[model samples]
Target: MSPPGATRGQPAARSRRRAARVAAVAAGLLLALLLCEALGWPFLRGPVERAAARATASVVSIEAPFRVRFVFSPQLQAGRIVVAAAHGMALPHLVDAHALRADWRWGDIRRWRDGAPLRLEALRARTLDARLQRLADGRASWQLGQRRAPPAGEAALPRFGLLTLDEGHIEIDDHALALRATVDLSGSEGEGGRGIEARARGQYRGHDLDLRAHATAALPLLDESEQAPALPVRLEGKVGQVVLAFDGRAAALLTGRRLDGTLRMQGPSLAAVGAPLGLALPATPAFELVGRLAHDAGVWHLVAESATVGSSRLTGDFRYDGTREPGRLDGRLGGERLALADLGPAVGAPGTAAAPPPPGAPPPRVLPQREFDLPQLRGMDAEVQVAIAELDFGTEALAPVRQLRARVRLDDAVLRLEALSGVVGGGRVDGWSALDARQTPARWSVDLNFDRVAIDQWIRALRRGGAGDDPRRALLTGVLEGRLVLAGRGRSTAQILGSADGDGRLLLRRGTVSHLLTEAAGIDLAQALGVLVRGDEALPLRCARLEFGVEDGLVVPRVAVIDNRDSTVFVDGRASLADETLALRAQVRPKDFSVLSLRTPVLIGGHFSRPQVGLQASRLVGRAAAAIALGVLAAPLAALLPFVDPGSGDGPDPCTAAPRSAAAAAASAPRR
Candidate 1:
């Protein structure tokens, strides 16, 4: 206090002593914290409960024996714990446990905080009850706190190294799946190894469900050792008339990380089986399928060994990847034969298992009217190639298609069929088609071409005469070629066709027509009588050409003509696709001389379902007057000449000029 230097030294010493005291107190507090941690810190139960309740947004309570310790890893034990549901949840409680214990690794906790899955070292529970629920709007009762973004990797589930449970009950109610189930679960440990078994009773998609499952204990699932065995699992379940069974082995259950199994299912309809899984499977007749199923990461593979739907059979390998933003399906499917009728349900045709319409409802329409599920198409992408040796149309009028192949692709609600080729009626068809479901009402377009088709084979005679008659007699014989380009917008096939606008043309070369029909058209009484007395014969044709233009579902003939050795027939017609009606007139111009002839036109009219044919009354009246006046004023020969033709068939071949005109018109037309 007296000297200046002494005062500065005294202040420094006091500061050093104060700092030493602070260090000692810090050391003592750390030592006490270590001791408490080793003893599980039972006295901190209230604080722990409060922290858990705040974290879960639920009411958490624990009875005596509650304890927690955190040195490097965390350990928890409690007696008679109860966790109430989060606010706004329908259920009152999420979990009620008579006894519960859990342990976790320090590294796993840190990894979980950094977006990795949390792994538990051990879990043991007794008399536990847990309830889980999911609403249609995607709210889940078990979801705690705010929702977080999904992890970057596979959405992995928590794993456990060792698990023991007794008298456990689990209930699940999922509105999206229309499923409500209650399960009784138990676990066992023995020399044979740990195992888990469960029995469930529920209702799924309006069907009563009964299920049983068994699997190797959850402990091995957490083991990453090379020597660990794959968990063996077996599940058998039935929902109403549908039966499902699976026997498999997996690296981890319910994760689809790695799985190998045999899956077998049989149901009244495939639609029913897919209902609870939210798959838009096509409606089908009673069916059964057995396949080798495997999964890795988020992809599923199925190699169908045998699949039968009604009388149809198919086998293929299919791959489905659900990890992408929009799921994708890729597959190559083929079979020896496929019945078109069996696939009717896919295009809205009524299957054999379909229920009849109500008594008061109108009969089903001829064209398919079921609207497409456009939203479902946006949920997935696909590229599938199909090939079939034979495709049966299920009708005697149309021959079976052979060597059918097509590549189908779907992306962003747009469906396209490319590289489409098939052989039918001894003809080749090549084309491409597309449906843009992204557009309202869905726009559709098709450009198809038919080449080198045998017309006679497609138009067979309905009746047969004696053995002496030719069995191959047909209405017409020719090599035909045609093209069609059309576009429309609608939700169903009928509506699409009703609004279609297009142009088309047909060409038949080196063909023949019915001799009797040709003679009757020209009213060649002598030749017609002679042909009728004998048998009908085939008359060689020069050529036939038909071209049409369509506008707003109305088709009008631009050129319709048939040229043969004896006569040239001209056809004028208009067909209404909207009302399904027909109106036509045919006039025959005789190319040869005939004594008795009536130059009258033929009229054809009616609905597509019922057509009427008769002579044109106005034309017949004019012809009659001309004949009568000629007979009165001049000789009978002169009178007959007015009604007969004096050979006008020697003109320039119209067939030669028609093709050139058609080509020019096509070239000048605007392209879509």
Candidate 2:
């Protein structure tokens, strides 16, 4: 019925039509699928629909992690959540998707604090809870740490705090917290940037801390707090102009663990933190402090540039490093001017002197007290120049102690006061002493060296007794020249042991030699100056060099003196310090130096002729008035003058305010 070629052509046409029909059907199916999706229909009505529902079920929010990777096509395939950025931030290890969706999803909040994060192995959540302080690069965190660093020299980086677990552990309130995290935070940052992040598993906080984390996004800060090892942090920087390295915890400190290291510091004047505290450590000649301090404990040192304590310009070096229990002071601190009228209260001195030192307390040492951590103190050595104000001496004459400097140290409560050379009462005093309070039974000792002291000057400083009282008699007048070296040690009154050596001539003019001079001299003078005699007229009496030696309780050579009028005065004396009485055996013309004023328990067994003299006290007059007056004195009408208050307790504080005297004001004229 058909040819071969015709048959072939017919089959081909049919095949072509079949292929076209199949293609049309496929296109229709695809269109149907797309339309269903747009119309919110389920493509895989059973399995796919159910799966999608379960996927988002109760999820409140999603916390995308940096580890997440995603590929979108006809079929979407996703890897783990990923965070990629350029910031200083640390993120978590894992997250519990279920838990995160339920309650822990972070809303649009900026800051988060006092929150714990639980990390998990699987992408899902578990039950382990790990609360870590997470910080972000923002202003909120930077403001939190600002409590100690203050806003004065304020500059900050966002930082977080996760105090040591040993500091203590926290208990939970509930499991309904608002914020939740399900993934680790990955990071990327610009130069010198920092960041943080973390994850939580089975996160459930209903009534827990309402941690608030809000801040400006562009800020930089410490974003994470891990369980880092407790180590001494050494900061290397400049403190004022001084370039110094501070050693950190060479010995055990935190929890008795020694962290050894060094932190170098160098800075401008405003940068020296310690300088403001009053320990004036040496710095560049520009009033800048530059030094290195190494401490064992996590402690801060103190310093001062120019601080005034009760009118005393305390400008010196003082350091305290607390390592041991009692601590240690390695260097010395002294000032040019001095002021401590309330010394009894200022330096822990109890009210009444008669109240007696604490049982057997050693005399006051010039060193600071042993109270704080020992090794924490920094050593000091500074030179301070200052001026002093007026103070009470004895009589109406003001007492001024000027141009004074001292080197002091306190090691384990054993304070050593040395280089205690000062000009007082117009005299030079040298030598030092020790106060061993380290032991339960405190002890004391001192070695004093005195130079030429004009005796008459000292008497004028005392408060007058009465209007009719002996005015000239007030002058324990004498050309007191010699080295009066006294060395002694004592614990209590009965335990006192020491001796004194006085080698010099006691010149008496218009004074009683027997009463004032204890060198076996018995010359009774009405008025004494550089001479001693009995008549009211001013007479001069010269006494031979006096010498006395005491071994335990026994006295040798009793007393002996040569008078100016070619008179030899000798007296034997016995003493009972506890009784406070003295007996005399001698003659001063008429009254025969008999028992003088017998105030102390002493017996005299020496004789003397009538020499120019007047009976008086043993503490001779001194030219102290000149030596103690360091600065210029105010005029009699100074109190009424500009900026001058003669009665003001606090005199001029050159380091701070202006002067109180007209003359001082004139001297302090501001220069252009």
Candidate 3:
């Protein structure tokens, strides 16, 4: 069926052919491997070692820090290095960057200035021991150098460019010591142009500070192919204190040299401490602040959104430039109930002696010599704003003066209070005023307006502190309108004694004089008056020119009542503070003049709150008709009496001589 030889050797031939196929396959694989080796890994021979050695020469010098251990890969390594440990060196020793490995990608060789871009790889080394500086000074000697003089015509040697690790650290201190960032390092190559960039973020020292930041820059020498367009960076940190809490952020365009960002810090409570006046502080007085802050070169600016100072709200803007002995501010401040204490921290006042940035921050920006003067108030450049729901002059008067509130704003040696409304002396006081905080000894003035007020209403209020609780007294109704205008200079209450000269009047209505002038002017116990006067006996006892005095000292008006015709009567003669009584020199002018029996000088001292007066004779006027009836009956009785007399007989108006004579004769025998 088949040829003899073809058929007989067929099996052998198949075997040989299969063997050949296997050999061919092996050859092809070997060829592929060889080709791959040639192109895939170009520097697999002594070339790599040679290149490494050349690259090492490019490093000016490597400073192996203390306690550093470097490890290298056996197959692909430049060289192994180990740093010595630092035992006790006072001069801060940074990073144990001892052991390290690097493969110079591009090397200065056989005049290869113009050619394809050179690249280097496998550029790394690991270390187990790495300890460095705790904190970075924020200032540095750029390892690269100062900006290179601008190229004469451009096309300078491709500016050098690189990215490398600098150092790392972690630390803690009083307020908050910071740790070093994993600073990435970068530099440029070539003449006339140079650039650099580095960035890193981490929790330094494994137990110190928290920080994250990045920076980058480039020199003009960077070849277009190796250059990035821009370098942008951001930084953040946190601060903690017993009385303060803080966190901040900052962002900048590194290459452009422009910065913009914000910072915020907050705490609870603070105290006002200075020479002259001292104040005790409290805890839980929450104070917080958030600022839209920025810094460029040495200039700084801030705008606070909102803050808390002792349960109060504050907001404003602030700015400063450079390290001047006296810094200046152009801003405004406002708050609801904040005190001067709570504002210390925000305004850069000395809050705590120890805090972050070490007392080393060039000493707080010099405070400027700023001043503010307003018609109503005067203050230092350091101004204040205050709002209060209630305040106690801490004196005895109306009980819980209701609806009491006020607002005060101070600035540049000027103090202005727009609203000061409250209940005083049974009347509502609504007004505004100003003070000169800068004037020698400071000057003050206020214009107060009073509203229609009830006397008994005030009396009852005062009575609460007195011993009299009379029911009839409760029925009393009276209104008083008055003015209290005064101006003077005084730093304290003691100064106000003689510093002020002012006048005030009391207008009365629908009330009895006994109620108003009971303690002031000795008056009719039962007469009601349409009006009355006050002020006099104490000072000059003038209805209009009433004067007051100071004892320990409190300025009090001498009691006097001036009638509508300006007729003034002394209620209490030369009265003075007598413990709790308005001692009156007994002088009584009664409805029906009654001579004094108490003494030539009666002491009419009693709680003016309520005085007892008895006049039963005056009440008799209510029964005038009864007395008239009795008088009428007595007239007729007189006629009968005359007739009964006989001798003086009462006959009809006729000539009574005869009758009289007869009567007289009858009377002569009329012994009976």
Q: List lDDT for all candidates, in order.
A: 0.72, 0.32, 0.36
* Candidate 3 local Cα displacement, residue 40, angstroms: 21
2 or 3, which is superior by lDDT?
3
Evaluate residue 547 in candidate 3 and report its C-alpha lDDT on the 0 to 100 scale. Answer: 32
RMSD of 1: 9.8
lDDT of 2 by residue, 595-634 (tens): 1222121234221111122332331122123223322375
Model 2 spans > 4 angstroms off? 1-299, 305-313, 323-349, 352-399, 411-414, 436-443, 461-474, 484-537, 553-562, 566-672
Residue 173 Cα positional deviation in candidate 2, in Å, after optimal superposition? 22
For model 1, the run of ten residues with the poorest summed lDDT: 148-157
Give the Å shift of residue 434 in candidate 1: 0.9
> Can you write out model 1's per-residue Cα lDDT over 1-672, one digit (the tens) per residue?
379888879889988998888888888889889878877798989998998777666788888788787876688999978887544577867778887897888887667656555467877788778776666665655555424423222233345676678877877676755768787778853335457786678887777888777876643432322333477878788866789888988664322356689989899877776555334455777888899888776687888788887777777788888778687879987877778887777666667645666776654345566776666667778888988888877666656778989998889888888999999658898899998989998988999998988766654442134222353455567888999888888887767777888888888987788878898976677778888899887778789988877767766667778888888887766776776766777788888777667767777776664677888787778878887898889977666766665656656665555432433433433221
Candidate 3 per-residue lDDT over residues 261-284, each given as its tens digit:
555555434321110011112233
Q: Clash number for model 1?
A: 0
